[model samples]
Target: MSSNKNKYCLFVVVIGFLTTNSAYAQNYKKLDSILKTANNEIYSNPDNVIKIGEKVVKQAENNVDYKIKGYKLISDGYSAKRNYEKSLEYLIKSSQLLNLSKDKLLKINIINKTGIQYHQLKVYDKAIQYLDQAEELIAEYPYKDSVHTELGKNYLVRGFIYKEKLSCAIAITYLDRGIVELMKVKDVANSSSKISIAVYNKGNCYLLMKNNKLALENFKKAATIAREINAKSLEAFALKGSAKVLFLEGNYKEALEALNKALSLSVGVNDLILNQEIYRGLAENYLALSQWSQFEIYQLKFLETQKLIKDTERTSVSESLGVKEAELKAKKIELSNKFYYLLLILILILILIVLFFYVLVKRKTNEIKIIKDKIYLLQNQKVKEL
Candidate 1:
């Protein structure tokens, strides 16, 4: 009867264990699905993305992978909203977990994203450092579709950096490589958006090179892809690029029309950067057409927008400094913990060494005593015999 009861209890425990594991698996799947949804809404509805990310962060609890992912999603959402400080804060949070994560791919992604954030902040050197780290990791990473996509993004950001530096020739090479890498990954999430961005950036580079024809062609292609992908902000930027090309070609009316279309799209997407660019384009077109009143109106709007951007940038810079301080504090604490851990290990080794030596000496001493006793016994026998 006792044996039967023991078997029954064992069966119940096994069933409970299986049930718990099954539920844990389901929970992770649900969280993954939620994160995917957040990713999809990152561009169009960034506020919604932030909310979903917060939910994921709370639900993930002590799961390192999921928490990092949640922080990344929040960072992306803030980036989309042009809140670089908040974005950097979340990215720093994700980076802090790198030591705790064994996922190489996750590490590469977080490093790459941190680089991109620096790029947005115009911290070119820091951006390059992070991108270089990501490149090293990618080189070590096994070949996979996702790796190709990440490599493409890395190249694309590098291209953007060069473009900002006015090295159009070098930028074009990197942008082309990025496009090729992205094309290698079929059906990858956000690949289309990334491709559009690469193409658009390429157009900007061409414009900088004074190659209006090539710039127009690239801009049109980028706009087509962006529209197909429903990436409204990218489409707006592409249109703005086209308008700039038209303006350079002395087609003021056509430029104005393109700028108007871009403004519509930008307003719909609520992209402040695009709005500022469009307003400036409108002002330029009106000035070229000798429409003084219209030019004045748009110029005022452009100035206001520029001021707003500057104000936001200033605030973001202040907040970013705070985040940096916090990160330094975290690093100091981690280093202190590591130092103490090393000290503990050294102390343990010293104790072990002392114990080992003591045992060896004691064993040798016992052997010597035994020899002395044996020698004394032999001498006593000799004396008795004598």
Candidate 2:
């Protein structure tokens, strides 16, 4: 009877332990779900990101790795709004969290993100500082999934910055370097878009230098690759670039045809910046052909499109901020529900522990009673025999 009671007590303990652990697993699974959902909406819905990131940051109050990811997602949302100051603020927070990690890859990624943020703020020197740090780290590690794509992005941004400063020769070198690295990874999904951008920019540099032959060659190759990858924006830009080269070569008819196709594609994609560029190109083409009415129409359209794009950007930023606030309010209620569930689980675990001890103590007490009775019976039997 005692042995059977002990076995039952052990079984009860095991069951209670499993139930408590299951509660822990459920809580952790909630954290994982928040992370996954935030990642999915990071690009598509910044407002949703703010809510999800808030939860992750809350849940990761003790986990440095998760804290880093949550902060980074918030930073990306701000970056998408072009609120560079806010973006940099969150990125700095992420960097502080990342300092706890000894992982080389995490460190490299943080450096790269910092550099990209500085680049967006037009702080070229600071951008170079962080990018160079990442490059040095990569050199030390020198692994395959290394910084290949990131380094390509670094060079491309540097090339553009130099071009903005009118240091065309230096810009060409950097652009060419980026082109080489980017082309090597052109088949990679993430790398393909940047590859096209690098090639197009390189072609633009050659055009600026009056190397029409090489410019046209690069533009054609960029267009072909962009088309293959279904990168509509890059393809449109490439077409526009090729049109410019054709215009320079006195092929007005061919140039206009390419411009028309580029304009159509840009419009279909609602690429306002490209659409404005296309409008300007059409105006120039019409002016060259001595078509005054067409030039006037397109020149006005170009100005109007630029204004519309600016207005749209401002409106979108405002809307995202408002939506984020609402989401946070809703998230509070959701978190409250989760907290209650957690409280219930805790209560259940406490009750189980109490019951387990009660059963164990009761079994021990009964065993003691049985032992006492056996002693009494043995004493009586000995006295009667004597």
Candidate 3:
């Protein structure tokens, strides 16, 4: 009977162990689901994206990958909303978590993304810093196509940064290296587009150096590749480069035609950067043609558009911050509830341990008492016999 009772108690313990662990597994699955959902909707529904990210972050404990992924999701959402400060906060968290991961490629990719974000915020030096770090890391990697492609992007962005600083010679060198690397990427779709961008930037660098012949050649090559790949944005950008060359050559009529075509393409793609460039191109073309009224109109339009873009970005950032405060408060409460649940589980395990010990001690005591009774009866029998 005692043996049967012990077996039943052991079975209960096993069941409790499985139940507790199963709950933990289910909780982790839920957190993963929330993270995936947030990723899919990050740009389309930025507010909900952050809310889901916060949920995953709060629920995740001691899981490095989950925490890092959650932080990334939140950062991406903030970035899409133009909340660069908040986005940088979460990106920093993600980078810190990289210490817990063993994947070198993921680390490099995150570093690259950080560089791009800094570039968008116009922190040009910091952008170069991170991109430089990515390049250094990728150097140790074997010469795979993917690695080459990433290196191309790093060099391309760095070249643009140099261009902004008006170091045309240095920019051209970087752009040349970028184009070379991209050309090594085995004819993939992404590689094709990157090659177009790299070459286009190279053309701009050449233009800055007053080398119109080479600039025109590179721009035409970029446009041909962009058209073949159906990358309309890049095509528009390449066309603008060509138009700039035409403007510098004093072909105002031809420059106006190319600029008009690029303007329509830029508007169709809704690329604000390209649109700004188009407006500037039109303003310059008109100025060169001695059309003062047209020049003035386009120049004013460019300034107005620039202001509008800034205003829209600021409004998005402000709105995201307002939404985030409320969501963060809710997440804190949810995290508290999770802590309580963990505490409850610990208490239950402690109770189970105490019950196990009590049962063990009581069983030993009963056995000892039975042995003592046997000794007493044996002594009485011996005395009676004597």
For lDDT, the strongest prediction is 1
Root-mean-square deviation per candidate? 7.3, 20.2, 17.3
Q: Global lDDT for candidate 1?
A: 0.89
Model 2 residue 314 distance off true place after TM-score fit, in angstroms:
11
What do the candidate models score in CA lDDT, each in turn? 0.89, 0.78, 0.80
Q: Which 10 residues in a row give candidate 1 its minimum summed lDDT? A: 264-273
User: What clash pairs does model 1 have?
Assistant: none
Q: In model 3, how large is the Cα lDDT of residue 153?
A: 78
- The parts of candidate 1 lying over 4 Å away from their true place are 318-386
lDDT of 2 at 103: 72
Off by over 4 Å in 2: 1-96, 100-102, 142-145, 183-187, 267-272, 307-386
Clashes of each: 0, 0, 0
lDDT, candidate 2, at 74 = 84
lDDT of 3 at 27: 90
Quote model 3's TM-score: 0.57
Tens digit of lDDT per residue, candidate 2, span 55-145? 7788876778777877887886676445555776788898987878877877887888888876766667767888889888877875755
